[model samples]
Structures are given as structure tokens and as C-alpha cells.
Target chain A: MSATFSAQDPRALAEAPPMLSLRGVTKSFGAVEVLRDVDLDVRYGRVTALVGDNGAGKSTVIKAIAGIYTFDGGDYRFEGEPVNVTNPKQANAMGIEVVYQDLALCDNLDIVDNLFLGREITSNGLLDDETMEKRARETLASLSVRTVSSVRQKVASLSGGQRQTVAIARSVLWNSKLVILDEPTAALGVAQTEQVLKLVRQLADNGLAVILISHNMNDVLAVADDIAVLYLGRLATQIDAKSVSHAEIVQLITSGRLDVDSARATTTISTGERSGSESTDQGAI
Target chain B: MSTVTGRDLPGLADAPDKRATTALSDYLAKVRGGDVGALPAVLGLIVLALVFTGLRSDTFPTTFNFANLINQGAGVIVIAMGLVFVLLLGEIDLSAGFTAGTAGAVLGVAVTNHGMPWWIGVIVCLASGALIGLVIGLLVARLGIPSFVVTLALFLALQGVLLQIIGEGGQISISNPTLLAVMNSNLALWQGWVLYVLVVVGFGAVSYRRMAKRRAKGLHAERFSVWGFKFCTLVVLLGIVTFLLSRERSVNVEATSIMGVPMVVPVLILLLVGLTILLNRTAFGRHVYAVGGNAEAARRAGINVANIRLICFIICSTMAAVAGILIGSRDNGVTPNTGGNQTLLYAVGAAVIGGTSLFGGKGRPVDAIVGGLVVAIIANGMALLNQPAGVVYVVTGLVLLVAASVDALSRRRAAATGRF
Candidate 1:
């Protein structure tokens, strides 16, 4: 159900600039247009959950933000300044980090090495393992990650949740401003899912802009401050997570539109007509 | 995703003294989890030594035979060290043998035909080797061709080139005394002991410095006992080997007493130490492991994966070339088949048997030494027993198979235990 402040939310006040904003972002593969005129904003200190059904262009939108693919026609504004980010390296230079669904991590390397994979700490042309290990330890500690027994353990030894946390920590280790997580909780167990969700919330709470892409409604509702729904390569709606109900979000996902009156009427009819359905059902049978 | 606080984990608490216990348990757990490392190779070495010594009591462990074994194993060791880099990246160089052959031919032609100095011949050999490597690297890295195919093609083409350079039945004899002395000559007794002492002291100093530095930084350093154990092992091993090499091996009045460590042994040791540092302590080495472990992950981390692969290929070929030079010196000439036939296979076998994985991301330079020695010992011991060539081949093949099996099984075990 839409709330009273659904349309007049103070987030739209435009007093402070959004942390990152994309306007009319379009991406096409040959003749197939995957994203069309998409507009989204990731505000500071907030979690923006990007939710959509399969093949709904959610991945395309995040990839564009992650600079894995350049938008065909759009303006990418980071902190209200237009910037060109054609590659992940450039995106990282601008403090944009993406933790992909695969959690790209070297399984043979230790946690410290994985955290500082490309950008290693070196002294006198030799790897400074001490500094890297110390920093990795500090980063994990700051995130309150306790599942990992030791930072020197190979990634192959870590659990799925621990790997996800390492990936998350790695993204934010280099002063990232916008951290994007793709299906972070999809493969995790319940306890691990809860831990990851808590970490995601903590990321936003620490004044970082976190874009969480997930299919689980409960997880999104629990951690996300705002929900942006994508329907068939188009933005269906952007709404506050607190104002949306499960049924309403489901309806929006399936139909790409929200009919408040019809949704409410359908639920009421289903519940209220149960007692009267006995005689009508016998007659129909 | 469970929300257990750090305090909830008993052993994970911030206890300063628990670092040693955690490290020790972690190491034990790793071993139990199938990260047996060099243990298989070490045990294999001991068992082989015992068997061979029992069979040929007069020659197997004799000072002369041991010195000869080191000399023969040195070429394989150097070549296998290079293969370690390529293997670490989950790639192989099938052309290493022929590449070494070509290098030897080039050196032979330069020193004999062109009358160049021995050092110049060495430089020429290395450059040609590097050039060969560069071409292969470009083909593999830039063209995205499979390394197996690229190296196989090189293997065939290099053999042809080597044959053409040396001509039919044309073997160039090595005239430079210094070049031949690498494997033929032995160090003086005093000099041998001096080098041994320096190596032990150097290793001790470096280990102590690194441990101190790690401790000062409040990082996870090795336990003092572990360090001490390693130091003691090195001293004892080096002491025995050096003592054996320094003894005289005079079989008859006509034969001069050949005593002291072979010059090639020290050179091989130096190369091993250098490569160990490169692989374990440098950024490039770390990148190699990363690329081998997961190329996509390395690329996503902004690493130039292709570049790393290219450099590794170059290193492999160049080292193959060096091995060729050593072989030529040891043989006193460069034949057309210098590095051909079973040379490359033996080098690969040495690396794998020494504990370097064919699957990659799990090997060290020390593997070359250990594995190469095993290969050498088998060939030498079998020869001493007057065994047929076929038997030697069969035994070596079995060893390689067993090593590969060990690698595969341990990998599966590690996967099962959720560690590697």
C-alpha cells in the first residue's frame, strides 16, 4: 500500500546532492537494447536496493554504474559532477567499487594477499607482508568480522559468508565511496545471510553509499532505505522501503506498475469472501 | 551471516599470546586438511636413497657418485626452476628441452666457429633463449593460444632449427676451459666450506630479520621453535652434503683425486635462492600465483594478466636456455639432440615430483632441487646397477605418475576439507 508521504518524501527535497546519479542511461547490445532511459540515484549514508525479476536489466544498470560497460547515452554524476568511467579501473579511481556475484577472489592466496591483490604494499621493491597483513586485520576488525579464524588463511579455507565479507571489505578497503553488492546473500546459509545483511547495513551506517542488488524481499526490506524496481529494461518506480508492502512490491514486480486500489481490493475480496464461498463452490462443482 | 560477536569465538579473542597457538594449530590443521606440501617429495627422496644405497652399497652413497649426481642434477634443477614459474600459472612449456638444445647450439657455434669468448657465447645463448621465449610469450599471451599448443609447436620447430644449426653429425666441442669447468671442475676444500658457512649464515640472518620485522609489526610471525627447527635442518643437511663432497674419491692410481663440491652445485643453489626470493617476496611473484590461482580474479583486480603470463613464458624459455649451456659444458660439446628427447619431460617431472603442482598455484623453487635430484638419482642408480635403459624409463614414468596422483588426491582432499 502506498503511504501518505509516498509522493512527498523529504528525500526529494534536493537540498543536498545525491552521492551518485544516472540520468537517461541507455545501453544496447547491437540491436538489442538492454537498458533504456534509466534514472537512479544513490544517496549518501543510505542503502539503495536494486530489485527486479529475471532479465529485467538490473545487472546492466549496476554494470553501467560499476563501469564494466559504458552507457550509450547518459550522464553519470558522481557527487553532482559529470564524470566518464569507461572501465572498472577508472571507476575504482573515482571511489566506485563493485563486489560482483562471483566474489572474484583468488582462492590460493591468503586473505591479506586477496585484499591487496593488485595494489600490494611494497617496500624496497619487495612485498611488505607485515603492513598488508596488519591493514587486512584492522579492516576486518573494524567491520566486526569474526567468522574468519585467521587472516593468513587461504581463501579456499574460508566459508562462503567469510568470502563475501572479504570481498566487501576489499571493496571498501581503498576508501570507496559507493559500494555495490550483487546477490551477496544468494548462496549463503541463514546465519551467514543474516551476518552479510548486517554488514551491508553497517556499510551504509558508516556513511557509505551501498547499492544492494538482491531478490529476497525480506532482506531488502530489512536493510534497504530505498527500493528501485526495474521492469523489462525500464525503471518501474523508486519508493521508500518502509512505505512498501510485500504484496504491493510483488504486484509491482509482476505487472511493472502499482494499482493501489485494485491491489487492496483483491486482498480484501480474497479474505472476506472465504466464508461465503461454500455455497457458490458447491453450485459451481 | 550469523551475528556472532568476536567475543563469542573463544580462540579468536584478542589475546597476544594466542598468536603462536593459533599459528601452530593452523599449520597442523593445514597438514591434516591435505596441504602436505613438500612432505611427499621429502619422504620419497629418503626412501629412494635407502633403496639405491642398499642395492649399490659401493657406489650409491659414495662421495664420487654423490658429486656426480649433483653435477648431473644441476641442469635439470635450473631448468625445472624456470618451469616452476610457468607451472605456477597452470601453464607448461613443452619446448623447454628443445629450447635448451637451441641455446647450446648457439653457444657452440659462437665459441667454436666464430671464435668468441666463452662469456660472449653465454651472453649469446641467453639472448637467443630470451628471444625464443619472447616469441612464444607473444603467441600465447597476445594471441590467446593455448600454451600447450604454442609450446608443442615451438618444440617441433626448435628441434628443426637446432638440427639445421649443428648440421648432420656435426657436434661442436667446447674449447673454453671456464665454460667446461662449470660441471667438470670442483671447488677447493676451503672454498667449499666457506661457501657452506656463508649460505647457512645468510639464511639464518634473513630468517631472523624477517621474523623480527613481522613480530615488531604485531603481525602473525612464525614460532621461534619453527624457525629454529628449520635452521637446524638446513645446517645438518648442508653439513653432511658438504662433508661428503669434500672427501677424496680415488678409485685407482691413474685417476686423480676428485674432491670438493662441484662448481655447478653452488650455481644451482644460487639460482634456487634467487628464484625463491622472486616467488615468495616480490610483487611479480605474488601476481604469478594470483594469476595461476584465478586469472579472472587477477584481471578484475586490475592486474595485467596477459603481461604476467608473457613474462613467465619468457622466464621459462630463458631458463631452459641456461640449462642447455650447462648441459653442453658437462658433455664437453653441443650435439643436435642436446636438450631434445626426454630432457623436457624429465624437467617437468622433476618440478612436479618436487611438489610443484601441475594444476598450478601450489609450488616452490625448492621443488626443482628436490624433484630434480630424485630424477637424477633414479637414472644414476639404475645405470650403476647396469639396469636396462627401458627399466630406467619405466621407473621414472612410475614416479611421475605417483607424483601426479599425489597432487590430484591431495587437491581433492583439500577441497573436501575446505582448504588448499
Candidate 2:
């Protein structure tokens, strides 16, 4: 998995510019500052994994990027130009789409309807069902998604993985430049998870900047080109996935920072004893 | 890494191979899985007809009785149709009855007292209804007030307004022959036949065009046999109704031909068709279902959830106004008691009985028609048996309970089976 990351160091690739970059982004609700001085960069044609423990403000960062919440203070640069996105509509207009964790799909509606919902294609004052269905099929086909039996099948009838794929496909359907997927595989089975991870890789390969928010270390390690770790409302570090080991990432997540040599020394000592107590101590911040 | 297969790739060619269940079996499975759409209502209608036929064979199946039954059902049907929209959002409008009365009162005051043209009065009534709905919608959607509470307040307030408008006499005779003809008149036999033919042909053409479009797009379309069966059933049903309505029944041995379909039936059908199109084939309709299904999801999708809720409420109240006009026409005037009593209850009952869910997002416009007919049949059958009003009320209550239970049970089944 690390070999895949080494084959493509996303930051070193100068062909695609950074699609979105945030510097000194701060957000607070009342007196509680959820995110403070968070800096992040999402480059086009690259998969950037944002991973953190609970209450680490990973969601706050993604929400800020998706424009679900306004940043109290920040410089938001989109493709080398500074921009302010006050709402989801403005973000959408700027070609930034968020595939939320909940999937945001109507269970009663069919795939065709769900895919073209809110922006239905109408010809001569009536819904052009045929055209919409055809477009939905074409979009799914482009993604190589073929598990769905029919476009007319309702979302409720779909499996967790298929629903995730449909949601992801919907975001990209509107000519999205940056797709932020929040825990795309959190509720999926193993096979479904594999399919979603593949689709995520395909999105980045298709030259769309992808920001994946996930808790699964394996998923992040397997697909991410650059892994950005958040710890306690602050960005601990952003590092290339190939250069880091599992214990190093864990140490960074739990303690907000990692002394690489000390972490290696601790790992070596723990391996000899194979004691759980020492491992826990090593994880402590 | 595992190789991709049809199970993992939904758009693959082999995906269809896994769906080996034939269309007929699939449909049967859906029915068995408790997706019996309007079957319960249709079955109830048939059973009611049989029971009435067994009890009062002489009068129950007569042309005049059936016509009168439809005429009486028309107002409730219209109201129920409006209620379906509200119910689809898992919301209730307790004020529909009084809203109807308010519109009727407005119509009466404008046309009779103020000497406005009947059409102008109708416009005022409809506009007033929309305004009332807008207010309730704003209170419910914007202020976050519960619809039950808001509509309940409107129910009381509107009833008082109706009473004030009618005054001590408790009635305002319309005196407009044109308005009275809306519910009291019938289409000629030829006209009724022509209307039925036009409807049948229109439906057939639409079905064919849809199938052709699907086929052309290489999508899964309904089979020819399925379409034919549906078309034939509709034709046969219309034929039987036309035949029954065309029969002339003698009044007091005077051989007075009170024949042909009631004028309101065709009007109701037109409204039903129009609403069905709006609900099924429009972007606004899609947003409505989306909001009803999951408001949070709809909001995230950039749909204005509050706006959708407001529009649905407006549709409900506007429909109530239309029903109000029908009620006034049927009674030949507006009375203080016009939309009081069990009218709102009956409308809610009809929508639920026809399979609209109380938990929002799982019903169709046609449910109103099916449920409305069921309520009407019960009332008509009871009246034919010379049953007291108390008995009618009890029976209606019991049926509503049964319908609601069926809805709850079916929802549980759908959830258990993982069917939407």
C-alpha cells in the first residue's frame, strides 16, 4: 500500500495545482473554539486523507471546506485565488461538493430521481424521465458501478455500498472539482468498503481533488497520498503516507505530535516485551 | 485485491443476470411483502357494494342513488386530495373543515350579498384560502410550531369567522344558478361517453409513449402484456360505470330521466389527473417527496425544506377552498354548519384509508380518490339502510381505526423486509 503512495508523491507532482488551500482557519461556537489555526491543502488529482480521533475537530475542518459553516477567520484559496464561501450553495457554485456521512438520499425515490433531484431535466414543461435515466446510467457506467440492477430501483432498496456510490456519483455528476467524502466507508461491509475505496482512488485519478475524512487507519493508509492528522482542534502534521508507519500515525493522532526516533525506540522495546501496558503508555499524550 | 464482479459493480452487463426473478413474480413478491398500494381500499369498496346490494337491492344499485353518492362524495374527495399532500409530509391539518367553510362563506358573501360575479367570488375564495394556508404554513414552517396546534387554532378561528359571516339566520343562499349547477347538474349521456373515451385514449397514448421512450433509451420498461391488462381493466371499469349511470330511473312514476354521470365526477377526475401529474412528474413534486422522506437530507441536497413545506400547506388549503365551493354548490348555499362536524375527520380518514402514511413520504395522490370513495361508500350505504347518524359515525370511526392499523402494520412489514 505504501508502494502506491511512493509511486505518486502528490505534493511533488507539479502538473496539477492545489485545488483548495486553507491557512490559519479558525472557527468557534460561542466561547468554545472548535478549530484554531488549521492549515490544510488539497491538490487536484490527489487523495488527501484527514484522520483524527473523536473531538479532534476533523468534522469542523471538513464543514469549513464544504461551506456548511462559516470560518471565523481564514484565508481560503481556490486554485491560487482567494475565495470566501459563506454557504453550501456558494461552495457548490464554485464546484466544491461534499458527500456527507449520512449520504443525504431520499429512500422513497428511485436512483434516477435521486440522482437528478432538485436539478431535474425538464423538456417542454414536463420531466424528461428518459433523459435523466439515460444520464444516470451513463454516469454510473463511467464510474464502472454495475451492482445496481436498475436505475428505477429506489434508494431504500439499495445496499449500503451502492447508496454510498450513488451519493459519490451525484456529487461528481455536477462537474465538481473538489469532492469531500466524510467517512464514506464507515457503515459499509468489507467488499463494499473495497469498492468505495476504489471509487475514491478513481475520483482522484480523474483529476478531481479528493478530501477523505475517515477514522479507519487501514483505509487512510491504503488510499491516501498525503495524510493530514488532526489532534484536539489543531492540525498536528501533514505527512506523506509512504514515509510513516502505523505506530507513528497512531502516536501523532493520540499525542498531537510524534518524536519519530522515540516512537521507534518505544516500538522496539514494546516488541521485545509484547506488553499491553507499555503500548498504552506509548499512546498516552 | 479481489477482481470486480457484478455484485460489486452495479452497472455491469452481468448485473441484470442476477435479477432472474420475472416481472410478474417480482410484482407478486412486492405485494406479498406488504406493498399492496390501493388494494385494501379497492377491496373495501367492493365489499361495501356487495353488502349494500345484499341489503337494499332495490335502491342501492339504482342510477339516481349512485349519482347522488358521487355528488356527496365529491366534496370529501377534493378535501381528501388536499389532505394527502399534508399527510405525505407526516403532518396534519385539523382546520381543513373550517377552512372550507370560510371559503364557502366568502363565496356566498361576495356573490349574493356584494353582487360580485360568481367567478370573481370563486377567485376571492381561492385567494383567501391560499392566504390562510400561507399564514399557517409560515407559522408551522418558519416559527417551528407544530401543524396540529396551528391548524387546530385555525379550525376554531375559521369556524367563528364562518358563523359571523352567516349571522343569526345561519345560512346564505347562493342564488347563483351557475354555481349551483357545479354540483347539482349532470353531463348528458353522450357527453359522459365522450369524456370517458377521451380519458381512455389519453391514458393509452401516454402509457404507450412512456414505454416507447423507455425502450428507445434501452431502459427497463413495463411489458406490453402488463400495459394491456391495465388498459383493459380501466376500460372495463369505465364501461360499467357509464352503463350504470346512463340508465334512467323513474321518479314517482313520472319517468323523469335523471341520467348520465354527475358533473362533479368529471371535474373531480380532471383535478385528480392534474394533481397526479404535478405530484409524480415535476421537480417540485420530487422536492416534496424528498423533504417528506428526510428533511435533513433534502436540506443537504440544497432543497429549501421550509419552502416545500409551505407550498404543501398552501396546496392543502387551496384544495380545501375548491372543496368548499363544491360543498356550497351541493347544498345550494353556504350554512354555518357547511364544513363543520366530521368533515375534516372524514378527509383525513379518506387519505389514510387510501394508504397515505401518517409518517410522511410514502403515499400517492390517487390514495385520496381511493380513500374518499371508501368513506363515501360507507356513508352512502349506511344512509341507504336508514341507519342513524350515530351508527354512521361509529362505523366510520371503526373503519378509520382499521385503516390506520393496516398502515402501521404494513410499515412495520416494509421496514422488516428492508423494502422502501
TM-score of chain B for predicted candidate 1 = 0.94
Q: Which stretches of candidate 1 lie over 4 Å from their true place?
A: A1-16, A262-285, B1-28, B253-255
For residue B205, model 1's alpha carbon misses the true position, in angstroms, by 1.0
Candidate 1 residue lDDT tens string, B94-193: 9999999899999999998899998899999999999998998999999989999999999999989998998876787887899999989999999999
> Poorest 10 consecutive residues of model 2 chain B by lDDT?
B1-10
Poorly placed runs, candidate 2 (over 4 Å): A1-15, A27-37, A72-74, A262-285, B1-21, B253-255
Clashing residue pairs in candidate 2 (N, C-alpha, C atoms within 3 angstroms)? A145-B11, A146-B9, A146-B10, A146-B11, A146-B12, A147-B9, A147-B10, A147-B11, A148-B10
Of candidate 1 chain A, the 10-residue stretch with the lowest lDDT total is A276-285
Note the B-chain TM-score for every model: 0.94, 0.95
Pull out the clashing pairs in model 1.
A191-B1, A191-B2, A192-B1, A195-B1
lDDT of 2 by residue, B333-377 (tens): 989888899999999999999999888997887898889989999
Clashes per prediction?
Answer: 4, 9
